[model samples]
Structure formats: structure tokens, C-alpha cells
Target chain A: MELICPAGTPAAYREAVEAGADAVYCGFRNDTNARNFPGLNFTTEEMGTAIAHGRARGVQTFVALNTFMRAGEEEVWYRAADDAVALGADALILADMALMDYVATTYPDQRLHVSVQASAANADAVNFLVDTFAAKRLVLPRVLTVAEIAALARQVDCELEVFAFGGLCVMAEGRCSLSSYITGQSPNMNGVCSPASHVRYREEGHDMVSELGGFTINRFGADEPAGYPTLCKGRFLIAEEDAYAFEDPVSLDVMDHLEALRAAGVSALKIEGRQRGKAYVAEVVSRLRKALSAPPAERPAQLAQLRRLSEGQRTTSGAYEKKWR
Target chain B: MQLPRPLAASINCLPLPLVQRAVALVFRQVLARHPGLFDRLGPYANRRFRFDPTDLGFSFVVYPAGPDITVYRAGKAPPASATVSGPLVTLLALLEGQIDGDAVFFSRSLSVSGDMEAMLALRNGLDDCGFDLPRDLSGLAGPFAPPLQRLAEAIRARALAGMV
Candidate 1:
């Protein structure tokens, strides 16, 4: 399977390339892409450099123009598509319906991969995208079990990419509105979830309280670990119980399922974390490269080094295993 | 302690202001080499960062000064737009993108104050800068660059073995 990786910056792109990433994905430094945190992503010139850098190393570069286009703002998304093609992006991962139509008609030859944010779960939805926009690939959402993935693989004609590692959002992408409900900013529209502007951390006695838009999300003890205040991962009081009502603070590590994923007809494994650093890109990519080529029995030992870097120092296979459902 | 460890320690032990001056010089080199990358900051070009490495027992402020980064020993004057405090290694790991910056922040290994936007801008700017210390430092020595880089890598590996 191809090792598709995330690169938030030009330096990270180089690190991913050096670390043996088959492809590195990035977005422009704007809300045009998901994972659009402040100070992240690349500029036009940097994008050109990143593409050239990856090409020189025989690694493909993919640009994500994944966010939905607001009315009257279609031109911005169109321009991003034009630039991605002009800059030699190997593929464009898109989510918005309007943008998909625009790209299919305007740049028919450019490879289009359906972003996971599109939440096209079953084979029918995947087929619709492939038939409609000529999407060359589909990034499956993190909600399907391995059996389900294998089943869908038999039905869909396009290439399939599954997220192999990084932060796990509990909700179906492009469909969740919890962030919009609380902060009035949706990942679909603004490319930000629990935006930094709405985030505030306070020290209340011995515990640290994390709030989003003045609403308490989670509180950590002085010695406990905290996470980014995304609404989906917050702890809440449900039925007189105060617990992680949505999802736990852990990352997705599916290195152990590599063979099974490949067997299930996955053409690529995507690593998340465009907000991370070069060391992260290098470490994750290099180690995964080792695991991918190593003897099957040696894979677990190779992935052990990544646990410390996992969020909250813990990891989950997520919905890849049936038990998560 | 090998070739680079003692040298790195000596540099680490330099008077705080002098160390800040040297860091300022490196920052100048990074900006000069990647002006286009830094230009992505746009309006944030004038923002200042107050970095306090508490474990290292010193602090410094870095800000853009007409296409160059200006660094000085931090003082008790007006607070900067952003202030990052952490152990020296943690800060280095954060700067190198070796770990998740938010993960470190959540783990309480690092802390930030002031304008979060400016902090984000600086973090992204530095990550995009692609400033590899060992490579840049070794390049200054001309013919000795490769050997210097090896030594520096050795010291860095030993120091950062457990950070992740």
C-alpha cells in the first residue's frame, strides 16, 4: 500500500520525503482546507517548492481543497483548484459538491480524491462520487469496521485510502455540527473546529479547565494530561455521570492492521496531523516505512516507539476493529 | 562525553544574553534564506515572541525587524504578544516538529500566554522555515560540515531519546 502522509509546512514535507513517505498531502494556509488551524498550511510559493521537493525525491504531492464553498465564495475554491493544477499537485482531495463539479468540468484530467470529510461511507455513495466527478480515489471515513471496509472495497471501483494514524474525530466528517453548535464555526464552512480564538485554558485551583467559547469542555487534574478542546472529545455530565461522554483523548494507531487493510483492498494509508512538526512527520513516516517492509512478526516492535507521541500517551485502533462500533 | 556534547554544553552555559545574541544570528540566517516562507506571516511580521526556558534559567524575545529576526534577553518590560515557557529540550522538540506542540502543551510540558494567534503564527513560521540546526551549524564550518553534523546528531539523539 502507498504511504500517504500529512505535511503542515514545507519543512515537514522534506522530513516526510526523507523519511520515505510515498506521498505527502498539504493545503493552502487558509480555510479552504480542513485542519486549518492558525499559522498552519503553505503559501502559493511554498506549495510550489514543496511539490518540487517531493517530485525530486520521487514522492507524490497532493493538495487538499477540502472545505465547503460558501455562496459567493466559489471563486476562492476555484482559484485554489487552478493553483493546485498549475503547481503540479498529483491529486486534489476535495469535499464540497460545488467544488467537485467545478474541478471535474474545469480540470477533468487532474486526479480528484474524495476527502474523508465528504462522509461517503457505503459503496453506493462512493460509486456516485466516482461516476459523477470521475474521482480517482476515496478517503474512507473513520467509522467503518474492517469487514465493512472489505465489503465496500468489493463494490467501489475507485482507489480507497484509509486514515492509519493521528487524531480521531468521533463524528462522521462533513456531517458533524457540534463545533458549529457551540462556537458558531463549522469545520465544513470555516475549516476550523474549536478554533483557537474560542479556546481558553484556565487554572482553577489544582485543576486546569479548558473552555470553548466560554463553555466548559474538559478539566484536567494538575498531573493529568489535557488535549485540544474539540467539542467532540469533551467530557460531559450525562445521566448524573461525569465522564468522557463523546470520545477519549487518544490517537489512532493502526500499524498492526496494515496487512489486513491491504488485504481489504486499501490502496493507501493516510496519516493525519498536519498541525504537527517535522520530527513527527519524519518519525511516523520512517517508522511506518520500517513496519510496512519488516517481517510481519517484527511490526509490533517497530510501532512501539510511536506510543509516546500518541495523544495522552495512548492509542486506539478506532473503528477499524468491529468492537468500536 | 564525546565531541559535540561538551561543545553543546559550553554553548548552553554561555551567559544568557550572549546565547541570545548567537540565537539571533542564527535567526538572521534562517530569515535571509527563507524570506518567502516568512512572508506568509503578512501582518504578523511585527509580532514578538517571549521564550522562557525555565529549566535553562534564562529568557529571550524574538521579533521580526525588517526581514530579519531581532533577538534580545527578555526583561520585565511590557509583555510580548506571545510568551512560550518550557524546558529547553521541550522547546527544541517543539521547534523541530519532533512532537505534537498541542500534545506537549496539554501534557503541561509547555505553556503559552498572550495572543494565541501570534503564537500560532510563530510556530507555523518556524516549522515552515525548515531550519535544521545540525545542518546549518555544520555548514558554517565549510569542509567540516559533515563531521560536525554527525557529532551534533549524536548529541541530539542522546538528549532527545526519551522526549517522544
Candidate 2:
């Protein structure tokens, strides 16, 4: 399977390529894609340069113009698509149906990969996108079990890709309203979730309270590890108990099931976190590459090295194991 | 008042101006090597970032847009948009972008306050530059570069291991 990595900057793009990525995916500096943070992402000029750099090294570059286009701001998404195609991006990971139609009708031959934001998990949805937009690949949302993925793979004609490691999203992809409910901003619509502008942390007595907007997300004791202030991972007073009602604060790590994923007809394994830095990009890419090439006997030890790197120093297989259900 | 840690008490004994001069020299060397380091932070560069070495009892207020770094004796630094406090080794490893920052932060080895976005931007900016303090400082020793880097690396390793 191809090892697709994430990069938020030109420097990280270079690091990903150097660290042995098959393809590095990123986004433009604005809200054309998700992860529209303060000092992350590349300008058109930087994108062009970065793509050229990756191309020379035999590493493909995928531009993620994955955000849904606003009603009247169709021009913004169109211009981003045009620039990405013009800059020779190996593929465009798109989510908006109208934008996909525009790219398909305008550049009939450009390879398209349906972004996870499209939420195309089933065969019909996946096949429909492939038949309609000539989509070459479909990044399955992080809601599928191994058996379900294998089942879906057999039914769809397009290539299948799955997220290997990164932050876990408890809500449905491209349909998250938890952030909007708490912070008044939709991740899919506004390209930011738990926006730092709306996040605050304060010490209260013996605990550190992390808040989103004005609502308390979670509180950690003086000696406890802190998690990000996102709504899905927040602790709530549910059923007369103080508990993590939605999901625990842990990152998704599915490296141990590489064989199952490959056998399930997966073409690529994508790492999430474009908001992360080059340090993370380089370190994870190199480690994943090493694990991919290591012998079966040594695979467990190699994969286990990544545990300390996970969020809250904990990793979960998420929906893949079907344990949560 | 006694310092909280041995590292802090030892560093607190040094003359403030001498320590300030030493830190400035290292900062100058890094900026010279990576000219576009802070430029990557964009508007976040204009904000003051304070690096507090909890073990060392000293802090650094870096105004990246001004292209200036000033050392302060612990809590004496000017107001900052963000402050990241940690052991001296943890802070240095973070600057070099060699360690997994989120892992360290999540493990509670580091603590951040003030503006989250600005701090995140600065962390990304530092990661892009790949600042290696030992190797960068080794450049100042002329013919003694190799030995200096080795010694610095040894000291850093021991410090992180709490051996020194």
C-alpha cells in the first residue's frame, strides 16, 4: 500500500518527501480546505514550489480543496482547483459535489480522490462518485470495521484508502455539529474545529479546566495529563456520573492491522494532522516506513515504538475493532 | 529563597548580564543560520513568546518580528502572548524539532499558557527551522567544533536523564 502523509507547510512537504512518503497531501493557506489555522498551509507560490520539489523526488503531491464551497463563494473553490491542476498536483482530494463536477467537466483526465469529508463509506456512494466524477480513489471515513471495509472494497470499483494514524473523530465525517453546538463554528463549513480563538484554559483550585467557547470541555487534576478542548472528547455529567460521554481523548492508531487493511484492497494509508508540524511529519513518516519494511516478527516491536507518540500517550483502534459498539 | 530544583539554584547563581549575553550569542547564531525561521510564523511572529526553563530558573522573551531575544531571570520577563514552561532539556529538544511535541505536552512534561494559536504557530515555526542548539553553538568554537558538539550532546543527554 502507498504511504500517504500530511504536510501543513513547504518545509514539512520537503521533510515528508525526504522521510520516504509515497505522496504528501496538503492544502492552500485559506479555508479552501480544512485545518485553516493561523500559521499553517501554503500559498499558491509555495504550493507550486513544494509540488515541484516533491515531483522531482518521485513523491506525488495531493492538494486537498476539501471544504464545501459556500453558496455564493463558488469562485474561491474553483480558483483553488484551477491553480492546483495548473501546478501539476498528482491528484486533487475533493469533497464538494459541485466542485467535483466542475473539475470533472473542465479537466476530464485529472485524477480525483474523494476526500473523507465526502463521507463515501458504502459501495453505492463510492461507486456513484467514481462513475460520475471518474474518481480514482475513495478515502473511507474512520467509521468502518475491518470486515465492513473488506466487504465495501469488494463492492466498489475504485481504489480504497483508510486512515492509519491520527486524531480520532467521534462524530461522522463532514457532518460534525459538536463544534458548532459549542463554539458556533462548524468544522466542515468553517474549516476549523475547537478554534483556538474560542478555546480557553484556566486553573481552578487543584484542577486545570479546558473550555471551548464558555462551556467546560474537561477538567484535569494537578497531576493529570491534559487533552485538547474539543467537544467530542469532553467529559460530561451523564446519568449522574462524571464521565467521557462521547469518546475518550485518544488518537487513532491502526498500524497493527496493516495486513488486514492490505487484504481489504486498500491502495493507500493516509496519516492525518496537517495542523501538525514538520517534526511530527518527519518522525512519523520515517517510523511508518521502517515498520512497513520490517519483517513480520519485528513488526510488533516496531509499531509499538509509536505508542509514546500518540495523544494522551494512548492509542485506540477506534471503530476498526468494533469493540465500542 | 531557595530555588525549586538543583538546576534552578545553580543557574540562579550566575551573574544575570553574563547569562543574558550568552543566550543572545546563541540566538544570534541560530537566526543567522536560519534566516526565514520566524518568517514562517507570519503575523504570529509579532507576538512575544516566553520560553520558561523551569529547571533553570530563567526565561527567554523572543519578539520574533523584532528579530530580538532577551533573557530574563525567571519570572522577570516582560508580558508575553504565550509562555511554554518545561525542563531545560525538554525545551531544547522542542526547539530542535527532534522530539514529538504533542507527546511531550500531552504527557505533561510541558505546560503552555496565554495564546494557544500564537504558541502553536511558534512551535510550527521552530519545527520548520530544525534548530539544533548543540551543533549551532559548536560553530562558535572554530577548530574545537567537534569536541564541543560531543560535550554538549553528552551534557544534554545527562541532563534529560537527570544524571547531572
Candidate 3:
């Protein structure tokens, strides 16, 4: 199986590849990719260099042209794909159907991978992309269970990729418009969601109140750890009690379940934090790489080491276990 | 000053327009320094937003909720006003000129509504107003006296010189 990793910047790309990623995915500096954080991502020239660097090391590079094309500005998405192709990316991970069509038609030889943003969970959606655009791989949504993955694998001809670690999103990957509804910024349109510009931390009385758009999401005492506030994972009042109603602030770690995933016919395992620093990329990729080679019974030890590296010191199998309530 | 819980809840839920104005005030203050940031904000500043006086916008209403200064234009449908919603920390980060609106929008850290054109316009306008940090932070220093006031005056003088 392939070890696909995120590379938000050139430095991170280098780190992931050097640390043993089979493939590294990144986006342009603009809204072309989902991890469109400021001071992160690659420029056109930087992308070319990064791709060359990866190629020299026998590691593949994938450029994300996943954002939906603007109505009158289709050229932007087109140009992004063209640039990625020009830079010699091994494949283009795409979500927008028009972009897929354009790429499939314009750059017939360039490999295409279906981004999880497409929310292609079932065999039909995966096969549709394969039949129509010839998608080489499909990054399945986080909503599926191991059994479902095994079933879907039997139904589709294409390779399957699943996120094994990092942040967990509660919404269906491509269909979420919650951020745009509140902040006018969207992952589909702008390649961003719950942007940092809207977060606020205030030292109120004995606790630090973390707010997003002036709404209190969580409050932490001085002794507690505070994570960056994203709305979906926030603690909120529902049924007269404050709790994590949508999802908890936990990272996903399925390293222990590698054997299950491999048995389920997954072709690639992806780690999700492109906006993270190089050190994080290196550590995670290296650890996962080791886990991939470890014996099935010994995987638990490696997973325990990874648990220390995850966010909030908590990890879940997420939807892969069919544990959603 | 101490209201009952029910009364406090009612009072806290002010109409959306007032919230918009308060957000506008924060934007105006932060953007006062950069004269070109608005144009740079591009399509993001084109929308308008509505908010109750107490409402900070969707950032507080949604995930990672907190006190936020929303930006939006009026005369739009509910939730469609050209508005940008984020936390005060995010606002401060933006004001420091370390962050961009596009980054915020994409990361799901900021939320928006309404007219895209108006929201973009507002963002661009504020971007144009650079941060006058020294002037804003001067109150934090000292005896609440004339020295800080004089320092603020000197900074203003330097600002005028740079503009000219």
C-alpha cells in the first residue's frame, strides 16, 4: 500500500518524502487546495522544484486542484491543472466534475485521483469517476466503515485511499457549506474552512474563553490545554448541557488497524495535516512508514508511540468503526 | 448591572444590525492604517452582513464560538448579508497584518454570509486601512497620563509624514 502524505509547503514536501512517503500532495498558494492557509503552500516555481525533488527521490507528487471553479473564472482552475501537469506531478487530485472532465479531456495522459472532497463513498460514484474520467484512485470519505470499505473495494476497479490520521471532520467531505454560510469562506469555493482570521482568544476572569466570530466555543482553565478552535469540533449547548454535540476535539489514529485496512483492500493510507510544520510531517510519515512494515500483532506498540504525537492526546477510528451516534 | 439569567439572555440577543455596526467599528479601527488592503482583499469584500448588537456574527454562533466582530452589509436576506465572522483572536491576528482573509476563509476559521460583492468590498476597504498599532495600544502604558498621550501624538505625526 502507498503512504500518501500532505505537504502544505515545499519544506513539508521535502520532509514527508525524505521521511518515506510514497507520495506527497500539496496545493498552490491560492484557494486551489483545501489546506490554503496563509504563509503556507507552494508557488508555481516552488511547486516545480518540489516535484523535481520528490521525483529524484522516487517519491510521487500530487497537486490538488480541488476547489470548485468560479462561474466566470473557469480559467483559474484550468490554469492550475495545466501548471500541475506542466510541473510533472504524478497525478492531480480533483473534486469538481468540470475540472475532472477538463483534465480528462485536455491532459488525457495525466493521472487523476478522486479527492475525498468528492465524497465518493459507494462503488457507483467511484466507478463513475473511473469509467468517465479514468480516476486511478479514489480517496474515500471518512464516513465509511472497514466493512463498507471492503465491500466497496470489491465493487470498484480503482485503488482506494483512506485517511489514517490527523483531524476528523464530521460533515460529509464535499457537501459541507456550513463555513460559507457563516463566514463566506468555503473549502469548495475558496479552499478554506473555519479560517483563522475569525478566531479569538480572550483572558476572561479565571478562564480563557476561545471564540469564533464572537461566539464562545470553549472555555479552558489555565491548567488545561487549548486547541485551535474550529466550529464543528467545538463544545456547545444542546438539550441544556454543554457538550461536543457535533464531534469531539480529537485526532484520528488508525495505525493499529493497518492490518484491518489492508485486509479491507485499501491501496493507500493518507495522513491529513498539510498545514502542519515540517517536524510534524517527518515524525508522522516516519512512524506510519514503520508501522506499515511492522507485523500485525506488533502494530499496537507503534500506534501507542503515535498517540503521543497526535492532537489533544486523543485518537479515534472515526467512522471507520461504524461508531457514529 | 446584574440581570437575571432570562433577562440576560434576552438582552444578549440584540438585533443583527447593531452587531454589524460593532463589527464595522473594529474593522474601521484595525484597518485605519493600511490604505491599500481593501483593494487587495479582492472579491471577498463584496458582501454585506446583518447582526444584532450583541451578536458577533456566525463565528460565535457556530463552531469554536466566541466574541467576534462581523463584517457585512445591510439590506440582505437573513444569513446572506455580506458578512465575515471570526474570533477576536483571529481579528487581532488579521489586524497585525500577519494573516490574510483568504487563508482564514479556507481553513474554516472564518465564516461569511450574504452579498459576495459587498463582503469583498468591506474586506478590501479594511485591508486598505493599515494597523495603527502604537496609537491603539498606547492606553496600555502607564499612569493614564500625558506621557502616553504625547507618545501617541508623536506616532500620529510620524504617520502623517509617511503618508505625505
Candidate 4:
């Protein structure tokens, strides 16, 4: 199976390919990419150079034109798709139905992958995308259990991609409006979630309080660990007891279940942090690529080393184990 | 040394204006250290402020619309143009340059009502403030902060090791 890794910049793309990623995925610096973060993403010339670099190393490249098109702004998304195809992207990962239709009709021979943001959880949704847009693969949302993934894989004709490591999204993909509610910036619309512009932190006596948009999400004592303020993973008082109302502060580590995912017909495993530095990208991809080839029995110990690399030193199988009630 | 119940109650009921004063004092200390931030922020520092709590009679409002800082109670609507509602601790964080405005707005950790242009100006102004810890504190208290910073540095070190 292919190891699909995120590359937020040209340097990251080069790092991923050199570190043994089978394919590297990235977005243009504009709103078309889901990670429309400042100081991140690539320009058209940079993408072209990155694609050339990836091709020189026998690694494939995928461009994410994954944000939903705004009204009267479809042309921006269309030009991005055209540019990706011109730059020799191995595939185009799309979320908007209109953009998908445009690409499928305009460039029938180009490979297309349905982005997980489209929330194609079942065979019907996957089949619809495949049939309508000629999507060759579908990136499954993080809402499914391993059993559900296996069942859906059996039913769907398109190839499947699952997030194997890094950040976890607690919400059903493509259905969340939490970011837009406060920041007026939608992940689906603006290609950014919990953008850095709204975060504020202050030290009060012994506690370091973290606030997002003037609201306190979590306060850490000088001794406690503090994670970034993403609304879904924040802790809140529910019925007088403080608990993570949505999800805990943990990364997803599915390295232990790689074999099961492979057997379940997943064609590619994705690593999620494109906004991360190149060193982080290189290290994780290198480790995961090694672990995938190792015999199943010997993989756990190798995977354990990745713990020191994870956020807050905690990792979960996420929705893969049906732990969500 | 036990106090009467009435006295304890009185002590607990400090004026909301006093609380706002204390927050402003701490914010002033932070601002003092980053004078360049004020020059960069320009007109945003002059905007009015409205602070409200979810509970009644606990609003601490500050209006920077005048030459001197003005503190007022919430019921009269404090002559300010913009209103931000949250705990005092969160406000201090925003004033101290500790949090990113975009992350806060997206998470709904903070809500700003009225004066959209002023809010945007304030966010950009705050960014220029540069809320990094003083060098002395970082050097002395490096071990106590979150380990992610250390881990990131370590990864960078390891990646650069033997190469340069």
C-alpha cells in the first residue's frame, strides 16, 4: 500500500519524498487547500518545481483542491485544478461536487480522489462520487470503526485511504461548522480551522489560561500540559465536572492496526500534519514507511518510539476501535 | 482569627470596577515591556472595551475612547463601541498577547459583538505586539514549560545533527 504524506511547502514535499513517502499531497497557497494557513502552502511555480522533484525520485504527487467553492468564485477553484493537472500532479483530491464535475468533464483522463472532507462514510456516498465524478479513490472519514471500514471497503468499488497517524478530527468530516461559528472562517469554505489569528494565552498566578476568541477553553497549572486551543478537543465543565466534552488531547496512532487496515482493503495510509515543520514530516514518514514493511509481530516496538513525537504523549486508535459511545 | 460571616461576604464582594482595574494593571505591565507594539498597533489601542460575564451584575467594562482609561458597570452599556464577553482570565490572555485571535474566534472561546472593523484592526494590532516571554524567564524557566516546545527543538537538533 502507498504511504500518503502531507507536504505544506516545497521543502516538506522534498523531505517527504526523500524520507520514503510513496506519494506526497499538498495544496496551493490559496483558499483551495484545506490547510490554508499563513506562511504555508506553495505557489504555482513552487508546485511545478515540487512535482518535478517528486517525479525525479519516482514518488507521486497529489494536489488537494479540497475546499468548497464559494458563490461566484468557482473560477478560482477551477484554475487551481487546471494548474495542478498542468503541473503533472498524479491525482486531484477534491471535496466540492461542482469542482469534481468540472474536473471529470474537462479532464476525463486525470485521476481524482474524493477528499475525506466530503464525508463519504458509506458505499452509497462513495459510489455516488465514483459514478458521478469518476473518482478513483475515496478518503474515508475518521468516524468509522475498523469493522465499519472493512465492511464499507468490501461494498465500495473505489480505493480507500485512511488516516493512520497525527491529528484526529472528532466531528464527522465536512459536516462541522464550529470554526465558522466563531471565527467566520470555515474549514470547508476557508480551508482553515481554528486559525492562529484568534488564539490568546495569559498567565494568571500559577495557571496559564488559554483562550480562543476571548473565551477560555482550558487553563493549565504551571505543572500541567497545555495543548493548542482547538474547540472540539477543549475541556469544559459538564454537570460540575471538568471533562473533554468532545474528545481528549491526543493524537491518532494506527500504526498498530496497519495490517488490519491493509487486509480491510485500504490502499493508502495518510499522515495528517502538513502545517508541521519539514523535520517532523521526514521523521514520521520515515518511521511509518519502515513499520509498514516490518513483520506484524515486530511493528509495535518500532511504533512505540513515535510516542515521544506525538502531542501530549498520548495517542488513541480514535474512531477505529468504536470507542466513541 | 475567625471573621464574622457578614465580613467574609463583604470581602468576597469586591467591585467589578476594581477587578477591571487589576486586569488593566497587569496588562499595562505587559504593554510596558513591548513599547514597540503600541507604535505598531496605532489607532487600535484607542478603541473602547466592553466585558460581560454570563451571570448578571458582574460586568467589568473598560473604555479606552478617552485620554484616560474609563471603567464602568455593565448595566448602563458602558459607552463603548465593541463588546467582548468572557472570564477575566481570558481577557488578560488576550491583552498579554498569549493567544492567537483566529484560533479563539473559531473555537468560540471568545465572542466579539459590534464593530467588525475595529475587531479586525485589534487582532492585527495584537499580532504586532509579539507576546513572547522575556528572555530572562525563558532561560530560567525553560524546564517548567510544556514539553512540546522542547521536543520540537530536539527534533530540529536531531535533524540538523552531523549534517552541518
Q: Which candidate comes out best when scored by TM-score? A: 2
| Candidate 2: clashing pairs of residues | none
Tens-place lDDT digits, model 3, residues A139-189: 988998888899999999999999999878868887898777667788888
Question: Where does model 3 sit among the CAPRI classes?
Answer: incorrect
* Model 4 lDDT per residue over A207-233, tens place: 667677778888766545455567887
Per model, how much of the real contact set is kept? Answer: 0.53, 0.46, 0.00, 0.00
Per-residue CA lDDT of candidate 2, range A1-325, in tens? 9999999888788889999999999999888898887777888999999999998999999999998899999999999999999999999999999999999999998999999999988988999999999999999899999999999999999899899988888678898888888777776877888887787776787577888888888988876766667888899998899999888888888888888998989999999878776777887898888888887678778767566667666789899987857
Best by DockQ: 1
Q: Positional deviation of B30 in candidate 3, in angstroms? A: 30
Instruction: Report the C-alpha lDDT of model 1 over B8-124, residue by residue, as the tens digit.
Output: 466557776676567777776655566655554667768777787755435667666454444444354347777887777778766665556766775677777666666777787
Clashes of each: 3, 0, 91, 21
Interface RMSD of 4: 10.5
How well is each residue in B9-124 modelled by candidate 3, as lDDT tens digits?
A: 66347676775566455455444443344443344433334432222322321110122245332223255344454454455444433344443443334454444345443443
Ranking by DockQ: 1, 2, 4, 3
Evaluate model 4: give its lDDT: 0.73
Candidate 3, residue A281: lDDT = 76
TM-score of chain B of each: 0.79, 0.88, 0.41, 0.54
Error of 4 at A113 (Å): 0.4
* TM-score for each candidate, following the candidate numbering: 0.88, 0.93, 0.67, 0.68
